[model samples]
Target: MISMFDSDVVSAELLADIVSVSKATLLKWEKSGRLIPSQNSITHRKEYKVSQLIQFEEVRNMINSNWDQELNVKPAKDFSSVELFAGAGGLALGLEKAGFNAVALNELDEDACKTLQGNHSQWNVIQGDVKNVDFAKFIDVDLVSGGFPCQAFSYAGEKLGFEDTRGTLFFEFSRAVKEIRPKVFLGENVRGLLNHDNGKTLSVIKSIISDLGYTLIEPKVLKALFYRVPQKRERLFFVGIRNDLVKFAKFQWPSPYYRILVLKDALKAGELYATDVPKSEGQSYPNRKREILSYIPQGGYWRDLPDDLQREYMQGSYFLSGGKTGMARRLSWDEPSLTLTCSPAQKQTERCHPEETRPLTIREYARIQTFPDEWHFSGSVSSQYKQIGNAVPVNLAYAVGRSIIALLNSIDAEVDLGSDSLAFNGSFHSRQLTLLNT
Candidate 1:
């Protein structure tokens, strides 16, 4: 997954694979004069080198990244954290990899609790509603983190504050930070949070975070594709430092992996996994549906089918506006998977296999989410799907965790020296700017 390509010069097909686009799409780009490639001297076939492809952001990031260096980051001291809404330990496991010790994890779902406790018996798994659990007991924790469910706030007026957010799950997350009084807090949510309720929801959230005596860093949505997860999932992350320690916090978002990962990397015995995806049960389409989907090509959707089949399969959606691309969609092996939903065979968002006619198996879904093969899910099939779907991808979480570790390390340096002069150059400052701007 880290070393994305074997050769410096690659064919057009390989280039398409690297960028997670179809070769036909590349042809279209060339026709539109967006991208024009050189031909190899001997074969006279289209070829591109890393330097020549710098115009493409994906290729440029792959060339500029310091992913190997970032992986070497280590915690300066024993940092402890308390996690709320810890579903099946994806975030917890990733943070653990990044050197944070979980002091406690709160989850209301019994199956998710079992998954957490089953995987790590030593974790102080608090299996109950977060509203009932008191965070006051946790003292001197380095971080308090969670992906609280987003609920729109009731509009009382133009400005909304902490008390105004009382009934929402975001308030509970804010409450934990208030009680624990950690040096820093981390929150994550879907990208929709940015525009929720026409931005009022996020405005209230920003206000509440400030009301709790913390300095909220401008929130950013991190793409899983840039973090070595073989899926195009995006999550909005909120990081805040206690006002007293805000001066010490010099945080940079995690660097992109040198190369993006695709479905081939996930399911095959390659950089991402030790073996091909393990066999497991998965949802299946009915006979008629399967027969209809059999006609669909890789990376294609309902529109790829014959006219009669398209009308039969899409029903009234056949006449709908917008590109109903997810309907009857068959994933491409060369591209990262579409963002995974709770189920594989949903009518609105079908996730059919690249070559096979059936839906992806449970193991395939877990692999795409970057869950370790050994980690066991602890509930019925549907519950397992729900837990994994709700989780932040493990690799994405690990990337964010490393950035947090760097931030904490900087704080430590500041505390010891009593000045900003001891600032930790913990980020890929030069490289990050280049990739981000592009």
Candidate 2:
């Protein structure tokens, strides 16, 4: 047998660098059985076969060709949607651009509601907890969407169904879906939710979605970099079509853009934006932080710091085994920006500007999220950061939104042809016999 830890086994870091993706992307690949890893005897760290690296590189190149395909994304007819937890309108705005009309937007955050109202005075910005609202009044809606926060559920000897999640926000999202009975629904969350509670949580979510009479598509965590957004944020998106509409609609995910975008495309006048980022308020680094970060070269991290400074900055973490890649990290203009954090200057997640040593300004953060320069965030600076950081990148949402539109169009056309039709999700289409009954 070949040696498990031979030179052919490559650490994930080397493979990520070789393919120009993040370590997080590599982890996802490992879980999906794309890049199988074996333990290195000397380091006991994850390593992959050299052949795997070449395979991934070829796939990456093929994705670049997909950017040229024209998407027939126009809304087939006037479609309306209701959005829950509409923070600063990132997802809502993107869906609107993809041609869904926003009927009403509900958000508990006062600042977020104000931001929505400020941006669109005519919008019905409902400011209150989602639990108190009744969604049935919003009839004839084609879609219901929300980026619900992920919370671990308490499994106390009960079946994980719609009622089991009563205490959590997901229950509220499900309730809205049940009451409104939209043709389709969308739910977005952090990528970690996929493996949360050893994947039991996601399994339960799918069950509840089925219990509510919708066919939940196999969930996917989409990397923002694969879209037009110049950031590496990843979001887990679930698209569920009503059982009645599934046979008529075949959902296809939005294709990746022709090219990967970089931080320069976000900050400067480029294909993504018509003008350079505007000057805006931003957080400042303390004197001590400024001194430490000044030494970090663009795209470099704490390892670049002197030994003493690294010890002081990382505290006891310096002795830790894992690669603390984000510590004192400075972004490079040529690469996609790392995922934005709720705060730009946290010691562990310092996103220093490529040219400037300071943290990126608010405008830059918005730009990285593919938020238009003119979109104003209403709140304290920190709150503004939180809203943007928590949002789905506008361009990524737009791409997915277009895919949903296409599915809806197909469903509409099929309905016109035959009153009783069926649709399926991704490639996990249910058997024709069971699909009709469901």
Best by lDDT: 1
lDDT of 2 by residue, 1-438 (tens): 122212555566445644667889988988998878898786566788765655664334433434445355688899899999999899998899899999999999999898999988988999999999999898659999999988877663136468888879998899999888998998999999999999878878888898899999899888887788888788899999998888799887777764567899999997888988999999999999899889988678999999999999999998999988888999987678999999998887888999888999999999999998889999899999988988889999888888888888898888666533434343333454455444
lDDT of each: 0.86, 0.83
Go through the candidates in order and give the clash count of each: 0, 7
Q: How many backbone clashes are present in model 2? A: 7
- Write model 1 residue lDDT over 1-438, tens digit each, in one string: 224654566668556655668878988988987776789897666776665677777777777777888899899999999999999888999999999999999999999999999989999999998889889999669999999998988765226567777877888898899889998899999999999999988888887888888899999988888888998888999999988787767898898887668899999999999899999988899999999999998778999999999999999989989788889999988778988988889889899999999988888889999999998898888888888888999999999999999999998887666433324443545443353223
Cα error, residue 380 of model 2, in Å, equals 1.2
Provide the TM-score for each candidate, comma-separated: 0.87, 0.84
Q: Which stretches of candidate 2 lie over 4 Å from their true place?
A: 1-54, 57-70, 156-160, 419-438
Error of 2 at 326 (Å): 1.2
State which candidate has the highest TM-score: 1
